[model samples]
Structure formats: structure tokens, C-alpha cells
Target: MCRWAADLGDAIFLEDVIAAPSHSLIAQSSHAREAKSPTNADGFGVAWYGDRPEPGLYRDILPAWSDSNLRSLGRQIKSGLFLAHVRASTGGATSRLNCHPFTSGRWSFMHNGQIGGFEKIRRRLENALSDDLFDQLEGATDSELLFRLMIGEGLSSDPYGAVSRVTSRVIEASRVAGIEPSLKLTAAFSDGEALHAVRYATDDHAPTLYTAAFAKRAGRCVVSEPFDRDGRIWREIPQSSFVTMTRDGTSIRPFAPATTRWALAS
Candidate 1:
């Protein structure tokens, strides 16, 4: 969706994918078939990349469905590359800062799923981040923390490698805490050029991630569930896989974390 043809010659609107779809992000907020929390009423956020390197961000502690601005803005704003998230609290306080699609410089990220016992190891994970990344942190959610950790793990240069390293560390920490030792997640991140996503877990299930091409338009969309009623069009990413989407096309490959211990630079 990074082509210059924003909204693909005006056939698709932002809301058309976020709010209007049958199993849209708004619908998944209420009864997600694969999410840990069915009710994503804690908060919502959207990050859209425009001409600038950094993406524009909007977040509020309201369910996406209840947010009038979200609807209004979605209808008006047009972007080829954007990400919207409806959050269901999973061991984090409900607040604007705790929302998804956390931003750092030009990078934007959003996630679905949870760490088995985030509370027990949150501090450890936080401690691993460098001072600069720690200073940018404003929320206590594991999703934001993971973004920063990915940054610390070298997201700017090695996006998927960073994610894999961080996931390995988190799962190792959870095991030490006598928790489930699982890091179940489906996440997407971008640096305003191409979008990268991963679906990985130490458990039996990984949160669902799917992508569908526009029928009448010239864009692609990735979602937690099928964006439209016709599930046949959406292709689910395989478990433990990495996907990279660009103006050229999308590519998928097997994904897994680095088993080596992760130690951030001081």
C-alpha cells in the first residue's frame, strides 16, 4: 500500500477497511475470534504515513466504535500506508499512552496477543532498553515496551531480526518467572518505506494475521481477521512466519527468534 496512488485512485477509504468491513477492526474489538480479550474497549489508535518521515498519530482511551473523531477522520483522511489498532487491555492500564502503534522517530508499530506473564518480567524487559528508548517510553503496556525493545534490538537496520531477538528474551524471562514461557503475538511495523509483520509464539496458537488485495482498487491490506465478509479472499499468514509488503509485492518466509541471549548496548 505504499504506492503514490493514495487510496488507490479513490476507490478505498480508510474507514472502508477499519469500520465498514464485516470483520473490521471495529467488529474485532467486540468479539475477536483470535484475540486474548474479546472486548477491545480500552483504547484505540491510528498511525498514517504521509509525505513526512514520521507518521501522524491519533490515540484516545475510547473504544474505536465510540470515537466520533475516528470515524470522521477516517472518512476524510486518505493514505496509502496506515495502521489502526483497537486495544483490549492485557495487564496494562487503560490510557492514551498505553495505546498501540507506538511511534519512535519514523517507525510505527502495533501488536495483538500477549506475553504470558508480562507483569512479572516487565521491569526486566524495560531495563534492557537503552536510555534514549527508555526516555521515549510513556506507557506501561507490553506492546509499547516491545516496540522500544525491538528498537533497542536494532529495528532501524534489522526489523525482523530485532523482533526475533526480543521475543526470545521475553519468552526466556517468562520461563524464569515460572509463567507460561510463551510469547504469543502477531505484530506489524514499518519505517515509512515498507511494512513488516511477524506471527510467532511459543505456544500452540499464534494470533491470526491475514492480508487481502483490493478487488476494485490498487492497494493491499493486512488485518487480524478478514476485512470483509468473504473470508475466501483473505490469506492467513502461516504460524511462525515473517511478511514484508512493499509497492513491488509481498513476501513471506519462516520466522523465529534468536535463541542466543540478548544484551542491549549500554
Candidate 2:
């Protein structure tokens, strides 16, 4: 899994989520305490909305800590909405295209965790995509394929529902292929207006996923783990839940499972 962070305001400030003291994302790249693997040196990427109408992206096949360019860029850039990721490849080439913060039009997406049984079910998943989305599938990672599926499924209007449907389809397809798919997914997506995030797992015990909210009015910063004990308000997002934030405020909602039983049964 990768680490990422996004800030939304007059502009977006998205960067690789790597500001924590000890177990920060940068730290995890070297000595991960929770991941199945201890090192995430495959690559890193970041995207943030800038003064232009479109967001800016910076990606490289270099470890986050070792990349001086990213360090210099991080200090120089600031936006109201931004995204950053450090990758651990799951069968894709370690290249810039395979990095996170994949962008399409005004939308940007970054995912943590993997799609279980991806290789077995890749063809089935691809066949389900629309021509337009299929044409745009650039890299071969399960994450990119999943994003295209969401786009082809018309998820722009209702992102939450779209993601749930896509996940359900992948899981059902994997089952048909005689693979017990166990997905661990936590994602953040934005269309330059609102940001949506979800934490979910196919098995009950999914990979560790958490979210923290920071309120300027309340003068608090919440995170996956406590960054500081400055006596600010911070809380963990419940498992199998989704959160959406806009200019007004943030709202939490339950993740409604998709009705893919028939699809699986077929």
C-alpha cells in the first residue's frame, strides 16, 4: 500500500502523505510496521490543483526518500487540493505511468491496497468496460483498470455508488474464476470540486486503513495516526465507510454493498 494526503481550500494541496514524525509514509517506504511488505521503493507520484484549470502531476520510478526532486517540489508547491502516493508494485512495471494520482479530465484518483485475484479476473473486468474507458486504459495495474471500470460505469455523478458497483463486479468475477478474492481498498478521489474517500475490504479484516479530519474553525488536525497531541479534534473513520468533503463541510456515510449476486451467479 501507498501513503497519500490532500488538502482542499481556495486551492488544493495534494502530496504524498508523508509528514508524520515516526511512521510517516516516507518512513514506511523504508521500515513499514503494518504492511505485508516493509519497503515501498517501486515509485511515487503526486497531483495537485494549481492556478491552471487542470491539476499538476509529478511522478517518477524512484523511492520517495531518495528523490530529491520531489523534496524540492514539495516545498515549492502549495494548493488547496492535492494527492500523493508511494507505490509497492503488484505485478506492473515500475514506471511513471504506473504511479498513483492517475488523472482523467478534472478528476484525480489515488488508491491504497490491491485487487485480489486481479490476474485471474482481468479479462472479465476489461470486457465489462465501455469503449471510451477501454481506449484510455494506459497501464496494466489493477488500480488503473478499476478506475477505468468506474469511469465506464458512469461513476462521475455518484462516485460512491459507482465504486461500490465496480468493487462488487470485480469480487464476483473473481469468484467465478475460482478465486476467493479478498480486496483491501482505501481510495481518495476528487473532481476539482469535492473530495471523496472510502475504506473497505472484502474480508472482514482488511488491510489497515484510517482517515483523519482537520477543521480550521476547530483548530484541529485528525490523521490516520496522531501527528501531534496539540489537543485538537481528530477521529478515525469507521470500517466500511465513505466520506465526502466539499467547500461547506465533511459528511460520513455507510458503504452500501452492490447487488452483484446475479452477476456472480451467472
Candidate 3:
């Protein structure tokens, strides 16, 4: 997995910090200090909301550390909502269509981590998708499958519910395939108006996920990890939780498992 960030404010300040700091996303790609595998150089992507209602996306099969176009674009474009991702392919092909921050209609999504044993249950999962959504599939990645599943489950209206429902279905599919699913997933989705994120895992212990706020300090920013050691307000998001942010404020809530009926219906 690779580090990613999203920011929503008066203007977009999104960048693939993969190469910015001393221990940036780019550093993580080739020499990750946290994961067993130390490389995440498969591909990278970004999405940002501009004047239009829909978000704009940029994806490349190039390593973030070597992408000059990304560096140039990151410095020039600005928006109020944005998402960035650095990928290390688990079971997916190395293609731009399989990149994160996938967009459809007016929504955008990005994911971190993998769906363990995805190959075992991929057929089952695919069978459950509606023809309309199934036909739209452009890549063969579990992340993209999860996104489509959420959409088929009605994410446009209730994002939290859709995610929970899909999670439950995936878990069930894994069980039937005689394999326990290990899902270490941190995700963010937005519809140009509201932003939502979830940090979850099938195991009792999940991966690192954090959130922070400016507090009363002006011109300050919050992120996954502090830019520096100034941790006056940076806080870790609790395990198995979801967050929602808008112009008004941010909300933290428990992420409950979806009902059996809800999962099968969708």
C-alpha cells in the first residue's frame, strides 16, 4: 500500500506528495518502512473538483517519483475537493484504467490496501452485479469491482450504507469460497458536494488511518500524518469507523456491518 491524501477547502491544494517530503509517497513506493513489501511503483492517480459539478481525474501507469507531468499539473491546477493515490498492484493489471480515484457520473473514489483472496470470489461477486453496471467495467481490479458494487448498491443516495452493504457481501462471498477475506481498506469518495471516508479491515486490527484539523489556528492544514512534528491537533481515526466532511464541519461515526438482507438485495 502507498500513502495518499485528499483536501477540501476554498481552493484545491492536491499533490502526489509521493516525492515531496523526506519520507514521501514516492519514498514509500520503493522503500516502504511500514509494509512487508517495500515497493508501490505500479501506478498513481489524482482527482479534483473544479467549477463543474463533476470531478476531474488524472491517472498514469508511471511511477509517481518519475512523473514530470504530474509534478507540473499538481503545481498549476487547483480545486476545492481532491483525491490522490499511489498504487502497488496486488491482483490487478498495470493499466491506467485500473488506477484509483475512479470516476463515474458526478462521483469520485480512491482506495488504499487490497482485498485478499479476491480471485477466489471474483466470479461470485461479478455475478451479483447488474448488467448495466457490469457492462461499464473497464478494468479487472478488485478496487474497481468494489466501486461498481457500491454504485449498484445505491451509493449516490447513501454512501455509508452502500459501503457497509458491499463489505458484508464480499465477506460472505469469501466464506462460501472457503477462504477468509482480509480487507485492509482506507477509502475516500465524493460527489463534488460532500466528502466521505472509511477506514476498515476484516481483521480485528486494521491498517493506519488518521485525520486532523486546523483547530483555531489559521492557515494550518490537517492530513493523514503531520507534515512536521507539530501534532497539536492531528488525531488518529478509530478502527472500523467512517468520516464525513463538508463546509459546515466533520462527522465521525461507527461503521456497522450491513444486514444480510441488504447485502443480498443489492
**Which structure among the candidates has the greatest lDDT?**
1
Would you give me the overall lDDT of model 2? 0.72
Q: Which stretches of candidate 3 lie over 4 Å from their true place?
A: 16-24, 30-33, 215-227, 230-232, 261-266
Q: Write the per-residue lDDT of candidate 2 for residues 119-184, one digit (tens) a residue.
A: 888888888877888888888898888788878766688898889988888878887999897787
lDDT of 1 by residue, 1-266 (tens): 00000122223457876777676777767777765556778888888887799999998998877889988988987777888888877777888998877898999988887787788888888888789989999988788899989999999999888998898889777766667786777888888788888888888598788876766666676778765655337788899999888877789999987879754322
Per-residue lDDT for 142-259 in model 3, tens only?
9889999999989999999999999988888877777877787778888988788888888866656666555333222223443333433556788899989887778889996586
- Listed in order, each prediction's TM-score against the native is 0.90, 0.87, 0.89
The list of candidate 2 runs beyond 4 A from truth reads 10-24, 215-232, 260-266
Two-way lDDT contest, 1 vs 3, winner = 1
Among all candidates shown, the one with the greatest TM-score? 1
Question: What lDDT is obtained when candidate 1 is compared to the true structure?
Answer: 0.77
- In the order shown, what is each candidate's alpha-carbon RMSD? 4.2, 2.9, 2.9
What lDDT score belongs to each candidate, Candidate 1 first? 0.77, 0.72, 0.75
